[model samples]
Target chain A: MSSQSFNRLTPYLFMAPAAIIMAIALFYPLLYMVFGSFRSWDPSQSLSETEFVGLANYIKLLGDEAFRESVSVTLTFAGTVVVAEMFIGVGLALMLDRNIRGMSLLRTLFILPMMIAPVVVGLVWRFMYHPTDGIFNRWLTQLGLPRVDWLGDHALMSVIIADIWQWTPFIFILSLAALQSLPRSALEAARIDGATGWQQIIHIKLPLMAPVLIVTCLLRLIDAFKVLEVILVMTEGGPGLSTEILALRISRTAQEFRELGEAAAMSNYLLLLLMVLTLGMFTFTRWQEARAQQLNKVKQEEG
Target chain B: MPKIRLDGLVKRYGAVEVLHNIDLTMEENEFTVLVGPSGCGKSTTLRMLAGLDIVSEGEIYMDDRPISRLEPKDRDLAMVFQDYALYPHMNVARNMSFALRLQKRPKEEIDLKVREVAKILGLTEYLNRKPGELSGGQRQRVAMGRALTRDAGTFLFDEPLSNLDAKLRGQMRAELALMRQRVQKNMVYVTHDQVEAMTLADRIVVMHGGYIQQQGTPEELFKRPVNKFVAGFLGSPPMNFMDVTLEETGEKFFARGDGFRIALPGRLADRARRVGQSELTMGIRPSDLNFDAAAPDSEAMDLRVSISEYIGAQSVLICKCGEATVTVEVKSETPIALGETLRFAVRPEGIQLFDKKTEDAL
Candidate 1:
């Protein structure tokens, strides 16, 4: 080969290892799962022995009451946890954005929850939700109040609360970063223009932080949808499938029900939902960059 | 219009004091300019007057009413910032009308006021555009429009034209001077440029190191600077200082220094004789030195021209008299050659004497 052809081939040679690993580790499983989702495959049978029954697994899930319940539970958990975390987390960031003494220590402590392993957080929260021996119930009993079942009757709510506690620091840190980066002069201008404290937040701070807040909320939503370890440790799809999200349902379908095709179909559904969210985040950043480019072009023309 | 007064206004950040007690009074509808180098506490005083910074001591009054404790909005003043802090998200009209909207003014009144101010600033065509979409000069116009819509009793400008290029700065300066005639308000402007202070101010306050060095009309400050600092700071080429000793020669007094001795004006001879200082510093402006080959050796200094900076119309020659360097400005058309020694006569009245140790005008 010519030296010019060799030079052009060097970049592709470097990318070959990553591409081969991606095909084997990522695309192989994805392709196998997607292709198997349209077949009638049993755990006892090899993949070559199974017959391809097009769309049968998906159609069966459409009518299955248990699968529908899992879908609804996953939606409720993801939606509720994301919204609740966003509000509480951004509010906490706003309240803590000042320069009081010991504020750096307090900020570090606030973000410590996000740094913990998900399994550890779940185990810690599970102990806290224990009916009789937990700190919360013990305090309730000492205060002359009836002990409420945390992980039994209100299982989904308990999982949602645990998710919020574990992930709110994610939103808080991002929101604080956005708030700190806002233009100081613009806020000063707003203050001199007669904006009160609340008015400044509403008119200046929130509007300026909107782009970061949107991306943060979407990232939290994506993480919330894939949550499994915390819910698995806390409830294990307990008390009649009340807190069984799609991840739990997929695991249970393949392990307990011995239906690999149905489990594969469920995973594809979750993937589709998350793809839309990821696309939304990418589009937002691209649009922001394009707008900035347009502004730069206009400025250049003026100059 | 109300007269503004700063009675012993001081600023301190924690234990570090930035401004000493500043006492200044501005008459109604007067244009008071604060001119100083960076970190001279001029901006601190202006921010204190705007209520952006708390006055650590003393009080500010407007028409005999104490206003130091009031909020910036309550002070009823408008300000144009150096960076032109227009809201990026809002259109020009909305940015200009923000204060009126906060006050809950009638929609028609707010619209009328925004349009009127926009028209005055030549921003009517671009009122619908956001600040991000406009050029810097356009954004600056929007900032001016926002301040103009307020109709406040006082206007404060913190070096508003310093962000522009030289041509734009000069253009905006003329527009500012034109606006000053139409807007009858008490204006306090802060800038490091003495040209802006001289051309725009009804009264100029020259400050240095947290102290007001001198305050007066442009001509008064230019002709009679209180000390050496003001003399060197206010001019383009700056006043030159040379070491000289006071010598009594017959009926006249001469400031004799390195290569030359020039007689002092008759009025200042007795004051020079009484001081009896063997060493003193003499100040002369570049424009005061004239090329006069016919002048007597006693009154003229033989200067060897080293470099001549030709700046159209006039050329400033960098010349030396023995070890002392002096500058002379003459018509550019004059025949001049580098490395040629020429005798330049110094006018007696142009000589300013200062104490060598104190640097105070004598």
Candidate 2:
């Protein structure tokens, strides 16, 4: 090969090892799961012994009531945690944006929940929600309020609260960063333009932070959908599928029911949902970049 | 328009004081320009006037009302920032009408006011375009239009034209001057560019090291600068300073220095004598020095031309006068060449003297 061609091939040669490893470690299983979804495969059976049952597993999942309930539960958990976290996170960020003596320390504390191990967070929250011995119920009893069932009838609510506790700080730090990076002069201009503190936040602060906030929200939403460990440790999808999110349901379908093909199909459904959300975020950022580039082109042309 | 006053104003950030006691009063509808170098407390004073910065030790009064404690909105003022701090998300029309809209004014009134200001600024065609889409000059106009739409009693401009390119700055400056004529408001502008201060201000306040050096009309400050700093700062190709001994020979007073000696005019000599200082600094503007080889020795200085900077119509000749470098402005057509000694006649009326010890005007 010529020198230029050799130089071009050098990068590919360096990338070949990682590419092969990815194909073996990532794509092999993905393709295997997709292939197995079309067959009546069991964990004990070899791939060659499985019988081809094209569309059967997908059709079964489509008609399954438990599957539909799990999908709805997943949606509710992701939606509730994301929306609640966004509001509370953005509110806290705005309140803490100013300078105080211990503001940096306070911000570090605010992000501590996200830094902790997810399983540990779940275990701690589980203990906190322990029906009678939990701190929450103990405080309620002391306050003359009725001791409520935290992980029983309100299992979904309890798991959601736990997830929110672990994830709200993720949104908080991102929102705080966005708030701090906003153009200071614009806020000062708003002040001189007679905008009240609330007005400045509404007109200047929030609008400027929209792009970062949108990306942060979408990222959190994607993560929330794939959340398994926290809920698994906290409620274990307890009280008859009340908090059986799709991830937990998929694991149960493969492990407890031993329906490997059905579990693969369920995983594909989750993957499809996450793929759409990822595409949405990708398009949003691309659109913003394109608009900015076009604006620069226009500015240059005028100049 | 109400008269504005900053009485004994001071600013401190923790233990470090950036602005000392500043007292200034602007008459109704007067254009006041605070001209200074960087970090000279000019912008700080303007921010204080706009209530953007707190008055650390003094009060700002408008028409006898102490407005230091009130919010910027209650102070009834509009400000144009250096970066043309137009809302990036808002279009020209929205940016211009934001103040009025915040006040919840009638929609028709806001629209009418925005349209009027846009037409004045020549931003009517770009009203729907966001700041990002517009060029820097257009963004500057949008900032100006934002302030104009407020119709506030006072307008504070903090280096509004500094962000634009050279040509755009000149064009915007002319537009600003024209706008000033059309709009009768208390306008306080801050700039480090002396040309802008000279052209736009009814009263120019020259500041240095957190202190006001001098404040007067543009011509007054130019013709009679109170000290060495103001004299050197206000003019282009700035005033040349030469150390000279004030020698009295018989009836006339002469300023004798190395490589040149010039007779002092009667008025300047009397002032120098009254100050009772023999060692003095003489100031002569480049514009006051004419290229005249035939001029008498007592009225002319022999300057050795070192370099010539051609800047259209006129060229500035950098010359050597003893150990000091002096700049002389002359017509480009003038026959001058490097390495040649030339005599430049000093205008008698243009001579200024400062006490060498105090650096204050004599």
Candidate 3:
């Protein structure tokens, strides 16, 4: 090749390794799962031995009671955890976003749960949520209250509580960073404009922070859908199909029932849901950007 | 409607004090400007007036009623910030109406007030535009309109025009001066630009090094600065200082430097005799020097022109009088060239004499 063509190909040459690695490590499994979703397969059968069952696995899941229950359960779990975590985390961030001695130490302590491994967080919460010997029940008994069945009757709530405990700090730190980075003079001007503390937050701080908060919420929503470890450790899809979210359901379908094709179909459904959510976030941000650009263009013409 | 007063006001951050024993009073319906260079405590003093900073030692009084402990809003004042702190999310109308909304004013009244102020600021066309969508000058006007819409008795400006480009700043400054005439509210403005102080201030308080160096009308500060700092600070291109020694040539007092000597005017000549200071610094503004080759040596300083800066209409010639550099503003049409020696007669009334030891006016 000529030197000019060689120069143009240099960037692609550098990217070739990462592209190959991604195809092997990521896209290969994805393609394999997608292909397997159209066949009747078992753990003992090879791909050659498996019979063609195009759309059967997906058709079966459409009417499956257990799969429907898991979808509902997954939505509820993800929605509740995200909503509760957002409220508590943003509240804590707003309350603590000020200069005070020991604030840095307090912030470090607050984000400690996020730093711990998710499995460790799961195990710790599982132990704490034990029926009678758990610290929570023990404390309730000491406080003259009846001990509640944490992981038995209230398995979904207990699982959600554990997940929220591990992840709220993620939102808290991001929200705090967003809050601290806001234009301080705007807040001061609000004060001069006769804004009370509450007024300042409502009128200036929250509106300015909405963009960051929306992105944070979307990120958390994505992670919440793929959440498997903490729930698996805490409830193991528990006491019924109550807390059997899509991830746990897929794992159980493949590992326990040995329905590899059905499990692949279920995994695709979950992936489809997450993809929609990711696309929704993208659309929302793009719309906002387009509106901003339009406004600027109009203003420029006027100027 | 209230007269504002700062009695021995002080500001301290931790163990270090910034403003010490500041005493000032702004009369009712007067425009008081606090002008100084950076780190000169002009902004700090204004912040204290706006209740944005703690009064470390003294109390602020309005209408003889103490307002040191009051919130900024309770002081019945509005402020324009240096950065034009408009709400990014709110449109110009909403930003201007924020204070009125907080007051729970009727919707009709709020709309009318916003419209009135917008019309005044020529922002009627841009009321629905958010700050981010507006240009810098528009955003600054929205900030000013936000303050104006409040109709507060006292309006405080903290370097509000400093963030604008030079041309825009001049435009806004003239607008502010026009506003000053239309509205008689007590206005306290802080700026490092002496031109702003001179043009807009009814009374100017010149500060330096966290202290009030001098306070008076703009002309009073310009014509009769109490100290060297004020004299050097209040003029454009600054006053030229040449160190000279006082020598008595018979009955006339002559200021004699390395390579030039000029007889002192009557006022300074009599004052120099009383000061009895052998060493002095003579200050003469570039505007006060006129080219007059035929003038007597005693009344003129012969300078060798080095570089002439052409600025249209008039040009400033950088000239040398021995070791000291002197600037003389001459008409652009004046026949002057580099490498030529010229005599510029000093205006008798324009010579400012200062004591070398104290830097105080003689």
Candidate 4:
């Protein structure tokens, strides 16, 4: 090749290793799953022995009531946890954003839950929710209140409580970072303009932090949708699918039911859902940028 | 219009006391400027009056009603910040109308007020634009527009023009002067720039080391500063300080130092003799020194010229008078060569003397 062509190819040559690793580590497995999703195969069978089913597994999942129930459970789980986390986290951030002694230590302690292993968090919470021996129930019994079922009749709530306990700190730290980075003078201006504390939060703090909160929400939602290990360790998708999320069910389908093709198809569905959510986040940020640019254009035109 | 008074106000952050007892009074609709160098507590005083900072001691009275404990909103004052803190999320009109909307004012009234203020500030064309989309000068106007729309009894400006570039600051200064005439409300502005204070203030308060050095009309502060700090602070090219000895020769009083000795005016001589301090600090404004080759030795001081900074009409000459340094503002076209020793006559009335130990006016 000519020197000019060689120079043009240099950037691509540098990217080749990363691109090849991605193809092997990421794209190849994804392609295998997509292709396997079209087939009906047992785990024991070789790939050549599997039969091409042509959307049979996907169609089966659509009609299956159990799969449909898990799908709805996943959506409700992701939506509720994200909404709850956003409110509590952002609220806590607004409260803790100040200069008191030991504030840095307190802030560090606040985000410690998110730093722990999810499985360990699940196990710790499982022990805490034990009907007779748990601290919560023991306190209830001592207080003359009836002992509440945590992992039994309220299995879904128990697992969700565990999930929120582990994840709320994730949202809190991000929201706090967002809150702290906001323009201080604008908030001061809000005060001078007669905005009370509550008004300052609503009008100045939240609106300024919307972009970060949106991105944070989408990130937590994406993670919540694919959650398995914590729910697996805490409730084990017990009490007949009450807390059986799509990811747990997908694991059961492949491992217990011996339906590898069906599991792949289910995983594809989860990926598709998360893809839509990420695209939504991307589009929202792009819209904000475009609006800002348009306003800038107006000013530039006048100049 | 209500008169404002800061009575024995003090501010202390933990063990470090920043402002001493500050007592000040402004007549109704008066424009008061607090001017000083950084860390002089001028901005702190303004913030206290704005209700942004809690008063560490004493009371701030408005029309004889103490307002120290009130929230900023309840204090009924508008402020223009140095950074021009317009809300980045809101458009110019929304930012300007924030105070009115917070009060649950009628939408029509808020819109009308915002529009009127925007037009006055030349921000009408940019009302729908976000602050992030506008240039620095435009954002400054939005901040001013926000304060104007409040129509509060008092306006507090904390170095509002300092953020702008030199050319824009000058233009905004002129606009502020024009606005001051039309707006009848009381205003307390703070800045480190003496020029802004001189031009904008109806009354200028010079501060140093957390104490009020002097407060008076700009002309009064310029002509008769009470101490070395005030005399040195309130001018473009600051006043030159010369360490001179007050010696009585026959019946005449002469301030003799380094290069030359010049006769003191009769009024200053009488005052200097009463306190009876031999060592004195003499102050001469840069503009007071005039080039005169044939001037008498007792009336003029000779300066060895070094550097001439040609700034338009006046060239500020950095010259040495004996061992003490001095700056002389003279016409740029003056035929004076570098390294040449020249005589510049000191006007009798322009001489100001202070006690060397106390730095107080003699």
Task: Please identify model 3 stretches exceeding 4 Å from their true place.
Answer: A291-303
TM-score, cand. 1 vs. native: 0.96
Per-chain TM-score (chain B), model 3: 0.98
Which of 1 and 2 is ahead in TM-score?
2
Q: What would you estimate as the lDDT of candidate 2?
A: 0.93
Q: Which tens-of-lDDT digit does each residue in B96-137 have in candidate 2?
A: 999999999999999999998898888989999999898888
Top candidate, metric TM-score:
2
lDDT per residue, candidate 4, B1-362, as tens digits?
78999999999999989999999999999999999999999999999998889899989999999999999998889999999988988999999999999999999999999989988888888888788788878988899899999999999999999988899999999999999999999999999999999999999999998999999999999999999999999887999999999999987899998977999999988998898888999999999999999999998999999998999988999999877789999999999899999999998899999888889988
Runs of candidate 2 exceeding 4 Å displacement? none
Q: Candidate 1: list runs displaced more than 4 Å.
A: B273-276
Best by lDDT: 2
Model 4 misplaced regions, further than 4 Å: A1-17, A289-303
Backbone collisions counted per model: 0, 0, 0, 0
Chain A TM-score, prediction 3 = 0.96
Against the native complex, each candidate's DockQ, computed on alpha carbons, is 0.60, 0.81, 0.58, 0.62
- Candidate 1 residue lDDT tens string, A1-303: 999999999999999999999999999999999998988888998888888999999999999999999999999999999999999999998999988999999989988988998889889989999998988899999999999899999999999998888889889999999999887767767777888878888888888899999999999999888999998998998879899999999999999999989899889989999999999999999999999999888888987
lDDT of 1 at B197: 96
Q: Say which prediction, candidate 2 or candidate 4, comes out ahead on TM-score.
A: 2
For candidate 1, what's the RMSD?
1.9
Model 1 DockQ (Cα-based): 0.60
Q: Name the 10 consecutive residues with the lowest summed lDDT in model 2 chain A.
A: A162-171
